[model samples]
Target: MGAGLSGLACAITLEKHGISPAVFEVRERLGDRFVNAESMLSILQKPITDPVAFFAEKNGIYLKPTASIQRLLVFSQSQKAEIEGSLGFINYRGRHEHAFERQLGRQVKSAIQYRSKATYEELLMEYTHVVVATGDGEYTRKMHNFRTDLTVSLKGAMVTGDFDRYTPCAWLDYSYMEKGYGYLLPLSDTEANLVMAYPDYPENDRLDVDERWGLFYERVCRDLRQPLRITSHFHVTGYPIGICRRARIGNTFFVGNCFGALMPFLGFGQFTALLTGIYAAYDICGKGAYEELTQPLRRSYENSLVLRRAVERLDNEDLDRIVPVLGSRWGESILQGKSFNALRWLAFALRPWMTKR
Candidate 1:
């Protein structure tokens, strides 16, 4: 029902099957939000290495990534690690000329009703089938279908800096915020998106976001050895990271974050979100069962949740030890290998460490 990635993908898929569907978006235009960049990590999407190729060849959904992620630099409180490979791809999100939403918007033939206040109840009375891709869990929550694992507070900005377009950096420091992480994904040689995400637990309710961001920003500058100037910024609080218990109820289908596409581990769900939308379209076309098509994605989400729980038990000392391992041959093997499930193995491997401290 929304014109975000999943909604547009749903419309495109329906169009491919000769079915024209009405699309609605809450925003005035596509990409009408803060500009940022997100990674489609190959390590996260195992067995299928290249998400861009996989989407086109498997689902007939073609998408262009901003750049191939060839290197990953991770920093802990006392350790730094670098991993190099065809790690993944980066895609610009939000308001940008080449943003993912705009790209998907271009592929759809149907007109999207912007500033749409159309509710699901009203739509249900008209359309034979309704696909809820509102890009959030609110509607699902209202239906008593969403199970929230945790809520996160995020502060991010588009910054001008000297950056390596092929490399993404991550920071794991608890001094600024507990169980929080920061990342930098370059849009180009001179521009990048820097973001910090942390759990919005009750204990953190009184924490100052600006103070935390300031510390994180300084750390990034020191680590990169380049001062960055903020071009634009965004802040979000109490953003739910969870799943819907039911993907569908009656003729209504839920895709994207509405259907629990956001994984708890790192919260990246673009690949799963696109697949769910396509799967919903497939089911609508009598080609497959939506629930069955999305079973693997649900499994991945569960696996990520387990990993997130294990990671929650770790402290800065634990990260100091683990960061180096991530750059080691064993870690490289796990990340590079395509045969086994990397997420599952990672969660399993963290069991001992999680119990130790």
Candidate 2:
């Protein structure tokens, strides 16, 4: 029902199957929001070395990445680690020509109704089938199908800096934030996205976002040995990270975040979101079953929750001990190897830890 990545992808797939569907959006245009960058880690999407190429060849969905992520730098309170390999790729998001939403929107043939205030109840009375891709879980929650695992607060800014386009950095420190992390993803050689995300639990209800940001920013500047000028910034609070118990209810289908495509551990779901959209279209065309198509994605989301729970139980000391392991030869092999699903194994290994906590 929306014109974001998943909705646009759904429309494009439906058009390819000779079915023209109506698309609507509340925003005046595609990518109508704050501009930023996001990463698509190959390790997160195992067995698929190149996501851009995989989408194009396997699903007929084409996309362009801003840069290839060849290295990752992670810093804990008392330890720093570096991992180098064919990590992943970074892509621009939000209101830009290269943003994923605009890229997908340009592929649609039918006209999209902007500023749409159409309700699901009203749309249900008209269309034979309704696909909810509203970019959030509000509608699913209203139906009593969503299970929220956690709510997080995020503060980010676009900064001008001398950045390595191929390198992404992360920080883990309890002094500034509890069970939270900071990261930098370069949009280009001269600009990057710097962000901090932490849980918005009762224990952190009294924390000051600005004060935390100040600490994180200072640490990043010292680590990089350079000052970054903020070009723009955004802060989001109480953003839910969760899943829908049912993917399809009656003739209504849920895709994207509405279908629980977001991973709780790192909040990555672009690839999965796009896939759900395409899968919904396939089900509409009698080419596949939506439930069966999204089974693996749902499984991945549940698996990631295990890691998220484990991370939530960790302290700065635990992070310090783990960051070194991530940079070791064993860690490198686990990340770079394609023989087995490292994420699955890691999640399985951490399941007991999570349960004990």
Per TM-score, the best of the predicted structures is: 2
What TM-score does each of the candidates earn? 0.96, 0.97
Error of 2 at 33 (Å): 0.6
Give the runs in model 1 whose Cα sits over 4 Å from its true position.
348-357
- lDDT by residue (196-244, candidate 2, tens digit) is 9888877677788798899899999999999999999999888888888
Model 2 regions more than 4 Å off? none
**Global CA lDDT computed for model 2:** 0.90
lDDT of the candidates, in the order given: 0.89, 0.90
Window of ten residues with lowest summed lDDT in model 2: 200-209
**Residue pairs that clash (backbone atoms under 3 angstroms), model 1:** none
- Please give, for residues 1-357, the per-residue lDDT of candidate 1 as tens digits: 888888888899999999999998888999798888988988887888999999889777778888999999999998999998899999988888788899889889988899999999999999999999998888999999999999888889999989899999999887778888999999899999999988987656778879879989999999999899999899978888899998989999999999988888888889888889999999999999998988888888887888888877789999999999999989888888888777878777776765576
